[model samples]
Target: MKIDARSTARTLAEIGKWRGVLLYGDDLGLIRERAAQCVRQIADSLDDPFRVALLDQEQHGRVEEEVGALSLIGGRRVVWVRDAQDALLPRVTSALAIDSDTVLVIEAPGLASRAKLRSALEAHPKIASIGCYPEEGRTLIASLSDLFRDASVAVDREALFWLSSVLGADRAAVRSEVEKLVLYAGEGGKLSLDDVQDCIGDSANATLDDATTAAMAGDRAVADIALERALADGLSPIALARACLSLMTRLQRVLDWMDEGKSRQEAIKLLKPPVFFKKMDSFTKALERWDGAGLRRACEAVQGFELACKQTGCPDLALSRRLIAQLCLGPRSFLR
Candidate 1:
């Protein structure tokens, strides 16, 4: 049977008692967390400890042998096939057909409506396919409330929005941020925007924002400082490269929309995560300073730096520092 995102966790916990279960989702973190919980519960209930095998693409052949083995101590067994790809569908299907006390949990990527594996799982009564799409606005708010309630802290709606906007769609990051806020607030305390800014606010994000903002405003010194801080924070060279490329991409898109006569408000409205109203001015200035050609060149430079970091095997901190320095000194002709 298929389970919607809302009921997935509860359903998985309950279904684990059965002989077999198939858990698949797009989010690797959520999938592994839920699957591990289920497996632990099943192991606890068995008379003898079960063998847990984590199968991957390289270990596809081992599935058949593992599935065919009789429980050594005559208790429940579990085989976890993680990161399942299309190549293993036949083997997985065959293994699932075996009538045994062992539970096989196959975790795969997200599936479209017409996907064969999804169709097979949907058809199988013992199998369940769960979708773990990023939470929407209301869902995120609800999740935040639950997280705060569990931590014995209260978050005002405004603070929740601030957290959500800053963290975007990363559930794990949001949970961590909430924990940081709770710790900062201490016991029996309420969470506020300032509390969040003080504790959970990432220095890298702030520095990146500042650096981009300074670059937009033509303040090289301020931009340099911001980039330096970001590098000092142990940000990877590849990560910095990606961030710079991402900013350039956003700037280019904003420029394209502006060229088509779209107002900044309208363009922001159409963008994912919906750029905050306060950031609109900064975004506009960045877009003005870095047009399409400039953005493309920045992307190319970052890519080259990323390749160098990988090839040189430099420490992440050293690589990031060098890359940031290069970016600071690199030609701004791309912004032309």
Candidate 2:
């Protein structure tokens, strides 16, 4: 069965009717989330050692073996394969070919549309295939509204739009943000755009985002506060450096768009995994300090800093802070 990602909840409602399920897509959080949801539908609990089996790429060949075995407690077995690839198609096909109560779920990330494994499973009458791409804006907003309604939080359309734009990439992040918003608003409280922005942008995750933008914008005071808070909360220095690198890459793409004669708004409209609404203005300002060479320099600095963190006896935390501080100065000021 070819099930649409948007229809996963409805499909999962009937999960027991399917012999096999293949969950693959770009949105890893969604893929894993839906996979777990399906498992919970078919099984009593994931924690039961005798009833559930967790497999990965390294344990590829054993899925069929585990499913075929007789359970100690005689319960229907649940076999989950993570990071599955096309090579496992034969096993999946053979396993699903049997009429059994055992459930098989595979998490295959980045499987091509034309991949033989996916096609093979889709062709099977008993198998269900779903692509868990990032949720569309409307779908995301609707889900957010549903959550808000359940929590008795009154949400305005503008606030929903703000959330939709900010959290299109990761469902887990979006869900977490919404929960915080509901809590922040309390029961039966009206939510506005400012409330959404205040709650989402002031989160722990947002602290890292603020640090990334402030570092790029060369705002010494803001950078210090953001970095200090993030570190105090146990965020590692290398991890923070990597976030800066990812942000820089996105800024570079925006720069490329600008160079091609697109207006800033037009360029931003084309970015994938979008710049969050709260950080959009800061990100735009930060890009003004760099061109192609400068962006390249920033990437190089982050890469070098990553290597230093791996070196023997390196003062990684302190070194990372220094490297990011230098990057705050702009690309032409690259540390020699």
Decoy 1 TM-score against native: 0.58
Q: Residues 1-336, candidate 2, lDDT per residue (tens digit)?
A: 688756777877788887768898656777787788777776677667787788888998887787786678876778888988788988877776566778888899767788888888877777789987655445666778887887999998877866665442455666767788888999999988887778776554435566778888887777778777766755555555656776787888888999999998898878765666767777888877878888887788788886676556888778867865886777767835
Judge candidate 2 at residue 136 and give its lDDT: 46
Computed on alpha carbons, the lDDT of every model, listed in order, comes to 0.63, 0.75
State every prediction's TM-score relative to the real structure: 0.58, 0.60
lDDT string for model 1 (1-336, tens) is: 787777776777776555455555434445665677667776554224346766777998888777777766665677777777567778878887776667777777444456677677777787776765445355767788887887788877667766654443434545566777778877678987677667765542544555655565455676678767755653345445545665666666767887899986677566654554546676666655565666677778677776666553556566555545544444464344
